[model samples]
Target: MKIARYEHNGFPHVGIVNHGKVNSLPDGTDVLETLNLPLDAQYRLQASAGRHHRVPLEDVRFLPPIEPRAMRDFVAFEAHITGMKKAEPGDGSVPEAWYEAPAFLFMNPWSLTAPGADIPMPPLTKALDYEVEVAAIVGTAARDVTPEQAREHIVGYAIFNDWSARDIQGREMQVGLGPSKGKDFANTLGPWITTPDELEKFRLADGRLDLEMSVTINGVQTGSDRLSNLSWTFEELVSHASRDAWVGAGDVLATGTCASGSLAELWGRAGRQDPPPLTVGDVISITVQGLGTLTNRISPQTSTGVPVPPAWSRRQPKESP
Candidate 1:
């Protein structure tokens, strides 16, 4: 089943795509809450799926499936690491004790947008970039999970775009503070969470995820790669992530970007000069097999701070409360 979080009539909703229509699920606090039915359980529910209302996919806006109690992104893809190593000096894709500990980013849980939305191009960056990744959504609650037992926690997978700012990231890393601001601006997700049972049909074909992956700027295809290129498996990510932390329903673990990032290695493969970074009106679309395409348009930034309307500025309380 293709599960999605969308907005209709200004209200956010959880839904499943049936045929080509989106069928609303029962109202719940988060994606997992509304659609936590497991594959077998969900199949049973379909016989009596309650409160469902179909809506056109275009009329509603999408949102990241989970309103996670906590969220982190992992670098589980080797191609991304190799690419970063060459793009910047001293950058090693083989993380220290990575196999043992796993590398992850503690990102802002609130900084996510849904599919078919407009992302504010950060004012601080002219070097805006994109990272195409595949991620897993955790289903059940568990702590200190073992690698062998990790698959039990996984619910499904989705495509992720870790939008980035190279310059801010470069400056922030100097402080060893993690990829805070550079990463917090926006992370695009959705197009639906495809479950494990549904995923089994895809086989690894020729060392690549049988799924076709590609990116388009506006309407032009720019980069492409396969899911088979992932360095680490989702099971490993789940085990490592749950080492000390509790992974609950709706938690998402992202497979880091693959070889085709907007910040591509011009000197390495193509030998073409690196293109200038993205600008306003640039639309980035990432398509993965099974999972559908996620498209977002770049819009100019307003202010560097959290978005606030002029009417909401807390003025001096009319010279005294």
Candidate 2:
């Protein structure tokens, strides 16, 4: 089932999508609460939705289906890393330790931007980029779960764009502890959510989906890849996520970018000048076969205030008494 959250008449409502229309649930329905419900309960919501109002899809504004309680992203695709390696001839082949297990990083839940919103370029970055990925939303709380059990907790999937400031990220990561300052500024997670049931047709024997994912920059196609090609499945990602920690309902996890999912990856292959970095006013459209498309436009940079206070101590190295 395709579940969605949208703004209508100045209020947000959760509903099911059918035939290019959204049948909103009665007012006051909480998106996360509805998604976390048991299958029977959620089905009931879908059943009763039709009795309310079935608004044409275009009439309403789309919102992020749910506000993630927490967010985590993983590097689950081999091609993405492999392509990055190809970018730098002597950067050393994809680090050997990468094969041991998947790598993930916590993302800021507060930074999520809705579909059609103008994404402001963080002033600290000149090389802004977008990562086209697929993210899973946790349906129920769990801990220490295995891959087999992780499936039970995952309720749905959505198109994810993990926006990045390559220049800032590169500097921060070199210190072995960052990505937060660079990433916390913004993230886009809208369009809508698609339940696993609606995507079973694309599922493979190995648990990955056979969906085609692609990205375009200002009306020109830039990259494309198949979802089924990931080295690790979403199940693995969820399982690894719950290894020793708690993952609660409404939390979201993303399978990092696909092979050609980002221009940075392209820059890694060729020179940065060829494809170049994302500039202000560039429109990026990411589309996954069944999940639909998410489009966002880059706008001029904005500064709210001074970035931060002084880092060093107030006293000088050897000040006179």
Candidate 3:
């Protein structure tokens, strides 16, 4: 089942996607509320379907499937990690600790945007890029869950674009801390969420998804890979994320970039300059099998009042002779 949140006639509505059309529920109903319900209750609600007002899919404006209460993005692809390490001036070996467990970083939930929304090019960055990924939405509160129990807590999945500013991110990593401003500007989620029941058929015996994920820039295919390539399964990622912490309904957890899913990785492997970083008017589309495509265009940067300094102004501090 595909669940969606959309705007029609200046009001937001939650609905189910069927036959290329949207069957919107009564006004003021929140989609997150449904996600918070128990799995059996949710199934019952689906079984007792109501006659909702239907609308043509093209008419409604898409919103992020839900306003996430919190977000965590994990780096779970070995090839992607190797590529990233090689792109920087460092030993390109995957960290040994990564094999032991999944590593993740908290992302700003407020940065969420909808499908078809124009993502503003962050003025502070000259190396803007996109990370094609899949996000699992939490269905219920979980604490200290095991990998075997994680899937039960996941309500659905959605396509995620973890927009990045490489230059800023590199500088911060040099200080031994994870990203901050570079990733906080924009992170998109939508088209809609595909329920777990709809994806069960594609799950492998080991629990990894067999979904195909791809990325396109302005209609040109740049990269493609299978979700099965992930070093850690979504269940493991969720389990690791919930270790000693409570993950509540509406929290979003994204699998990091797939192999060759971002420009940095592509350029690092080919030993060539990155295709021009995203600029105003460039459309980026990311699609995952079972989950739908999410498309966003780059928009002109808005003035933040603080000007980016010239290169000379970034010189190291002078020492006493």
- RMSD per candidate (Å) reads 6.9, 2.4, 3.2
Model 2, poorest ten-residue lDDT window? Answer: 303-312
- lDDT pick, better of 1 and 2: 2
The lDDT for every candidate, in the order shown, is 0.74, 0.86, 0.86
Candidate 3 backbone collisions, by pair: none
Off by over 4 Å in 3: 36-52, 305-321
The TM-score, computed over Cα atoms with residue i paired to residue i, of candidate 3 is: 0.91
What is the Cα-based TM-score of model 2? 0.92
Per-residue lDDT of 1-321 in model 3, one digit per residue for the tens?
678999888888888877877887666767877766666876766654335667888888998889978999999888898887777775778778888888999999999988989999897788889999999998888899999899888888999999999888878788899998788888999899888888999999988999999999999999999999988888888898999999878899999999989987887876665676788999999989998889999999885838556455437765559
**Steric clashes per prediction:** 2, 1, 0
Candidate 1, superposed: residue stretches over 4 Å from native: 27-30, 47-52, 90-101, 203-210, 264-273, 305-321
Candidate 1 — what's its lDDT? 0.74
lDDT tens string, model 1, 1-321? 777877788988777777677787777735564346656767764444336678877777777666666667887666666656665555445556766656888777788787888888886666788888887888888789986688777877888888888777877788767777788878877788887777776755332245678888888877887787676667767888888888877777887777665565432344443665788998899999888889999887866655335453466454455
Better structure of 1 and 2 per TM-score: 2
Off by over 4 Å in 2: 38-44, 87-90, 305-321
| Positional deviation of residue 298's Cα in model 3 after best superposition, in angstroms | 0.3
Ranking of models by TM-score: 2, 3, 1
